[model samples]
Target: MKILKLEKGKLDLFASVVQQFGEVHAPTEHEGKFSFKRLNSWSEARLDYNRTVLPPRKYFLPPRETLFKYREATGYVPATEDLEKRVVLFGVHACDIHALNILDEVFGKGYLDPYYLTRRKNITIIGIDCTPDEHCFCRSMRADFAETGFDLFLKDIGDHYLTFVGTARGDDMVIATGPLFSEVTHSDIVEYKRRSSQKCDTFKLDLEIRDLPEIFELEYQADIWEELGEKCLSCGNCSMVCPTCYCYDVADEVKLGSHDGDRVRLWDSCLFATHALVAGGENFRKTRSSRIKFRFYHKQRGFVAEYGRPSCVGCGRCIEACPVGINIVGVINRLRGVEHASTD
Candidate 1:
């Protein structure tokens, strides 16, 4: 992998150069939290953030989007090709990046999801190494840092970032920017590996991912779920904040007097009572306990069964976002019979 460094006062220039290729997006402060937003200046991008309120996955799979547009007289017509603009999603955390890869497997497998694919194809991913925060559990999920799927990867080395080239497209971007990076050496690679390894140990949460699915399977009917349901408000915050929760509902919205309207897809949460309800009014998961259990099992068990890996990256945003202080780690820990699972 090639290495590059942005000289002092050249980060904005670096961003500008990348912008010429496509719009540059990165984490920026919004309210009290960080968010992935369009970058107009280098200051707009904050690489030192622990996590964003929402994952960067929204860039590829929007929270809500139109699958297709149609007129009554013309019948169904394919959506316009308005997604040709390329994008540089900068400063994506490794956990979220890994989550995106999982999504790729889901959406790109079998019959391709044209909606997600079109947006994914026009974008380049640039990942930034993050120092784990108190809530981070990426190490537990083994996605603390990425080894693949990123065009460019950056690691902070005091005065400048040590950029790791991961793809030919990434190499071209670094070269085109010109003279920003020092040539990568054998020693630098060794140092980068050493530092990254050291950072992994910083995470307080550690678990054997190999045992996760089995643990979940064994705890499927466990009584801990009922206890969790008691504390859960069923507010749906956990699923909404999750990077891998891709459940959605599609509906057609029509104007008052016209048959012509728009077909839209909006985010849905399994925590909602009607999520699994059928036309005949049979609800598969009727109770809060069942819904909560289904949501967790879907991530830790069902998704692993379907995709060969758990959908959760252990980013821990759900733990932070929950108003009732629901910690998924605690729930998992309690299921595993860990002694110290309880946390207020």
Candidate 2:
């Protein structure tokens, strides 16, 4: 929990120093949007990006990954490709880091996913403070600031960046840069608090999360599901872009005319028609309405029952990614009987 300061001019030098630890990946502009990719240089890192098309979850639980390789002689050898690779994810937003913490709970408990856990250990997260946009409701979801689940976190405080060391590795990172970082001053603390208050006033979206699970349960039979189903393309764009959506499908890719095969897992969505299909072709959620309802219920209600919090981090990726302009904040307000949700 050590707080320090780095001059804005020295940020590029700090970024270069962290490269010795691992491959530095940061938000980079691509086709008018931003994505976390390997930075060719410090200049490519877009620290002020609003949001990425895909969250950093792709780094830990990849879109598709080989689980194991099978053969006649040696049975089911665990796939080790890229599991040991060290990566440094830089300039991550607070909500995305919170989403990773939620995923850690899901994958680290009950059944341990070595693939994900291994990558999680190898990857270093460097979180950065962000200004809330029109679509962002992370403050409502209690994810506007992260207390854990990051190695280093940076908050802009005028000419210097207030850096927080969250873990041992983060301490090592600070130590690695000889004189780049300096002790925080009283004025620096004042500047941080002033900006924090300013950021709070800028949120354009808000939602009441208290008693939300109960509200979702009461509205389970409401007409909104059908309305959303009609508009939803079942494209799975929301889940794909979501930071905490962890649904996955596993299948064995068998080699032609041989027993050799590779078992792989790919991202899946509850919205998909085949998601609920079973052995006898009996789908539990056959209708689009039921599928859509299940998606919301599981995140808002079911997850609360298990994890004490909704899985939705309120990063607004779902709101931004929905092609039909389905805004989650609007839906929640409508469900609560609010005539018009305030996005001001």
* Most lDDT-accurate candidate: 2
lDDT of 2 by residue, 35-95 (tens): 9999998999999999999999999999999999999888879999899999999999999
In model 2, where is the ten-residue run with the lowest total lDDT?
Answer: 335-344
Looking at model 1, how many pairs of residues clash?
3
At residue 64, what lDDT does model 2 achieve? 99
How many pairs of residues collide in each model? 3, 0
Tell me each candidate's TM-score.
0.94, 0.98
Q: Which segments of model 2 are wrong by more than 4 Å?
A: 340-344
C-alpha lDDT of residue 264 in model 1: 85
Model 1 misplaced stretches (Cα beyond 4 Å) = 4-9, 341-344
Report the error of model 2 at residue 264, Å. 0.2
